[model samples]
Target: MWANLALSPLHVAAGTSVGNGALLGLTRLVSLKLAELRITDGDCAGIAALTRLTELDLRNSRVGDAGVQGLSRLTSLQCLDLTWTQASSPPALSSLTKLNMDNCKVGGEVALRVLRSTRFPKLHAVHMSMVQVDETGRELLNAICSDSASTLDSFMLPSASISTVRFIGRAVALRSLDLTGVKITDSSWGTLAMLVSLQELELRGTNASNEVIKSLQDLVQLQRLSLRQTRINDGALPLLQSLQGGLTSLDLSDNDIQGEPALQQAWGNLQLLESLQLLKTKVTDAGAHSLKQLGASLRELHIGSTDLSNACFLRACEKLQILHLDGCRKLTAPVFQSGVRHLQELQALTVSDCPFISKAAVLEVQKDLPLRYMSCDDEVLFSAKKTEPIWKSGAALTDRLQELAPYDERCRYSTDELLSARYSEFVPQLESSGPLAAVLRELELVSTQ
Candidate 1:
């Protein structure tokens, strides 16, 4: 029920109790969200009074067709989200610029009827994820695409078929396209590659082939492309090499591109890549070395659940800001000594599941070079949980160690003097022992002093 006297975004979710009087009073409200609530058709009636409302989100609400009818009076509304809600039948919303009706109970026919009736000259974005569509729904979608293809900038649909995808291609003005759950194969790639204006394209879980994917090299304007969980391989990557200079973000995570040869080929290019994700992929130390080429341009990098060892971190990626080495089992103390210590620009580092790294070592490194966020496997300073009986007893052992007595007066001498004195004291005692033993004992004595 909180809002300023002027226009602002108001979000109220999780079935929070909001009275009608408070909702009706926000006449100047620009955006109002009432998601996951008990709001019904009657509650929506109060919203009709907010004539200036430009954005409304009623996702996961109990609103039905009647509630949608009540919102028809909101002439100034531009963006409306009815995701995971019972509301299906929408009124003619000519002013809407963005509409999201994902996972709604309504059939595509009713939704399309509303869409077909509405004139969205300025509408640019629409997301209908997980919504079932019939043949009639497909026709309506085609008709809607035909109507708004010139103006639409973004469109995301989960169950797009090849025909529906080709129809969507008519949206020449589109800059972003997300077809995550679509069944489009190599046949549809030709139609998709025609979207030369696309800046961001996501084909996650698609059946796109390497040859079909490389055809998108014509999209020189493309910046962010995600082929995660696709059929693309190493050979197909070189086709995408045309985009190496302009592409800023690439997500090839969760693919079958195994070994260093394939990974090396992928990383050999892309000098301007700012973010890269290679989680759950098989890559060895040799492949990890390929990342050194990116160096300063690489800002955010994730290499989780890989076969990379400490040698992977030897690369001088000095400008790296965020690094994720989660589930890299071979990584150990050398990660801190040889790799992390040198990355001066690192802000956040995640080393979870790296069993060889200890919490104490991480704390010491952080003390030397402070970081904004640091994550490890366990809550304690050590990677593994403490199993010692004393630790289980939960005594004030750590506090006692912090309050231990100072060094002896004789130990106040310089480190070099202490080492020289300790060598003199322990050298004769270990003279009969091997030279290695004598040297070890002398070093231990110096350390104790």
Candidate 2:
């Protein structure tokens, strides 16, 4: 363990044998991630010794008030993530440059005061979801913004009753701001537009409308914008197009965007756009045809739950690499045979719940093309011949056996099938593992499978 201590972001979650105390001895560690270990006061003492740590993520841990007290000693820590930790803090994170205390129990005025008094000279990003910030707290934030020595880049203060827009306008260097579930009106959009350096803005679940869109037209460096569940509609399209060739990713999912003409007129103008997600929209093939105009630059496209057919997708397959047609029931076999064959660079394809796609077509495509990744529901069918099945039963298991069963009649298996019989399997051994463990396992399985 000491030999490999140079690896930053060392995650010792549920399954691994490494304890919290052993992890603490790696004083050279810059990033320590021990999430969902059911860590308590005793476990946090180990973390307190990691004085040189910059990023400490204890998310979903059972750490409580005692654990919070232990974290106060980590003065060198810059980024502290306590999301879903269920910890009632005495505000131990004063020197942190980035702090995420989302869904925690640090919402009172005392908590705010403790956070405000902290000497975060380089604090840049903060996430305080479900915290109760009143007028005074906003004024405190305003004071923090006025500090010329500090550089706050991103802030998420959902449920904070920040009424006035003037306070935020003062944050000249802010790049990303999320005020979801706040009472800020459309008029505040003008004030927020003054933030010249703002790049990614998320106003999801907000009351802001087309006015916000119009206000953001002047932000040239803006790359990613998410206005999910907002009142903004097709009227916002023109404002979005104003960004034109600059914006790379746009997510207007879960809105009332209807018909292809609106999307066509909107997206056809984003020439530099690479990723576009229009999930649960009223877009049809006509709208998809309009999207095809962007085929030259678009790399990742998601049209889930939309009224689209294979023909629409085929029209734009020339440059698509990551295609997600999940829940697009109308997709047919000819679509894969014709449309997918043209996508020479296609690396990952997902057609989950699309009853129209047959197993035979999937195998034929794997045999004919050089796809590196394919996922259908719980199973991930792949083309690698040396990999073994990751799971043997349940919906999580791939039906690859059934697909290969017919060819193998009493050792009559096809030579190619026999060579490719092994399927990579992923099964978690630890019950207390965090989401990251699952992700790592999946990634390892993907590389082998």
Candidate 3:
């Protein structure tokens, strides 16, 4: 086992305890991760001989300050993760460029001392989520932001307060910031706008002021923004529209946006936008109509849970590649024959839960195009609730349905001659099955059976 100690990466067992026999032979490993292991202070002494180690992760481990000290001898270590551990004091890691101490029970003073004394000139990213940040920690953060703003560009500081956010804004060089589930209000918008270099920002499950969108206007370089499950409403749409030119991806899913009039007015203005998600929004046919402006540019569009009819897809999304129309209850067969089938660029389509659509229409489109994926389950069962079978009796209709039922069970429509000869056997059944009532009754029975 000791013969291969010079390997580039070494992974040990999760249950491995301190002074385990397997670890005795490994000393020349370049990267070591003892995450979620029973390793303690004494075990770290065995790993101290791996001077070539460049990465170490002791996350969720029982390692304490003594174990941390033992591993600190690795002068070449550049990345260290002590997440969810009890390591109170971290040694001065001059060579470390990335450090994650999220959810650790470390005190503010110890963290401050490390941050102040640590001399990682190349340090570019840090994650301090759920870490207790006292006044000293805040000062330490401000010092890092002011002194090393140029080198540091990415930060993940979820649960951070407004003061911490203010301090972070001083790092003008930041290109990415993740404050998901963080608590901050509109008051911090001005401070946040200082990150002029941010290219990607994630604020999912976080709430900020409507004025926060005003702050985002200065982020001309921002290409991607995720506001999923946020409290922003229709009034904030105009502010979001300011990022039309440079922004390519925007996620407004689970928001209370009833309409997108600002986006409708600026339809073609967002020429660079490639992906837009409006899932679970209160968008209706009007909202879908406004999306026509993006049909030529957007590669992926999600309008699920919106109240749209077949008319929405008639605009012809010439460049659209993926479309999601789930829970669009108003859609029917006309959407397929008139609108959707014409989208030659469409590679994937989802229309689940649209009870007005027919399995036949979905199948026709599937056969016409080489669609990579198509979901149209729960289609309409009948032309309507009333009307009698054009056929003589209920028994005759049941026999015909019994024959078509086999293939229809797998899909909404039959793929064999039964459906292929719709003009002959199928239409006649619909015409005889009252084109509505009787045929649907049999279909319901077959499905239930």
Candidate 4:
């Protein structure tokens, strides 16, 4: 009966061959999941016929090389999760924007060659955690700095990768870079400074400090900079003035940043700043008071686990939208209720692990504000909506989504595979020259003289 209609996301994990026959006519299936499923050689192989599938999750499934070979032609495929599979050769994923191949195979040599920026030109996030690379010298870096360096917005490699790419300095067209959990080599500091067009740079959980800050002074065009959980201290705060004119979002969370004279002196320079994250830093009441100066433009803020007892700073940011107040022992209920009512734009609020906030106080504040989502001391993070399917709840999901689509073997290598297999004909224009960059650059060139 469900076969006549266009079906949605389907999951077939740890199930017998009962409903597999009724899953054939679902040509509009957008997402499919088979993670940790007990399947044989040709069990769910018929899923290769779903041409419109944009996302697929085969993580932890024992589906070997043959199973993934069918997915290589999914041109509309934007995201793929092949975390714990035995597939050696990466299928030619032409339109992939995000990929997770964690612990697939060590020394990902063959995978590196296929990881060319031109191949997956739209590739944004690549997770190679727990996988070691055999590429020495500049092989790993050069593969990333290919012809399509412009379209690759983000390259999140949170693994033990240490290499100095000499060509990265020349790739000025490439700006948005994420080197999370990868230690920056001493020699690479000079190379990083050459990217003057860098608007978004994230060095979260790395070994970056003032020494690296000196090289980044030339990044006046930088807008979004995240240095969360690094070795940055107050000494580097002075250099922030160089990029303050253009920077909108700045994060110095979990660092040794002491908020006092240094916070007011250096931070007061940022007049156009928007979102700020100072979670778990050494910011005191003096630093907390200074934030009101930036309240006009500041929209999102995360100041959890600080030594500030006062919640009066929340009264200033009338334009504030999202806020996180987790692990703040000093925040009392009366103080929070009085301060939060000022924020008319507040939508998302997180107050987890605050021993001072009572449930009665939370409901009282809810009356005055229009908070869409709240997370604190509850199993359910959001509301009781159950908006999206829980992918990991294998058997439970399969029972609810029984009539997704019928499986078939005849159309596995259909005409859709032939078309999406080829690489893009033209190299996409660099995002740096895109519309948003043009608008931002125009704003930076605004003069006060």
lDDT of 3 by residue, 18-106 (tens): 46456556667777777678877777777777778888877777777777866668899888877767776555666767777767554
For candidate 2, write residues 44-124 as lDDT tens digits: 777788788888777667777667767778888887777767664434555667777666555445446555666455668
Q: What tens digits encode model 4's per-residue C-alpha lDDT throughout 1-449?
A: 55466666776544534134445577788887766665433544556667788877776667666676666667788878776677654466768776766655533544554554236456655555444445531454454455336655544444555444354665566557666566766578667787767777767778877778777777777887878888888776777765433778888888887666555564545767887888788777776877887888988887765577887888888898777776678888888878888889887666667788876676677667777656564422343222322133334323212211111121123223312322111001112222222322333322122
Model 1 misplacement above 4 A: 1-32, 42-52, 105-109, 158-164, 262-269, 310-313, 367-370, 378-449
Q: Poorest 10 consecutive residues of model 3 by lDDT?
A: 424-433
Q: Give me candidate 3's TM-score against the actual structure.
A: 0.74
Which candidate order results from sorting by TM-score in descending order?
A: 3, 1, 2, 4
Specify the poorest-scoring 10-residue window by lDDT in model 4: 422-431
Best by TM-score: 3
TM-score for each candidate, following the candidate numbering: 0.71, 0.68, 0.74, 0.63
Instruction: Write out the backbone clash pairs for model 3.
Output: 388-434, 389-433, 389-434, 390-432, 390-434, 391-432
lDDT of the candidates, in the order given: 0.64, 0.62, 0.64, 0.61
Candidate 2, which ten residues in sequence have the lowest lDDT sum? Answer: 425-434
Cα error, candidate 3, residue 25 (Å): 5.3
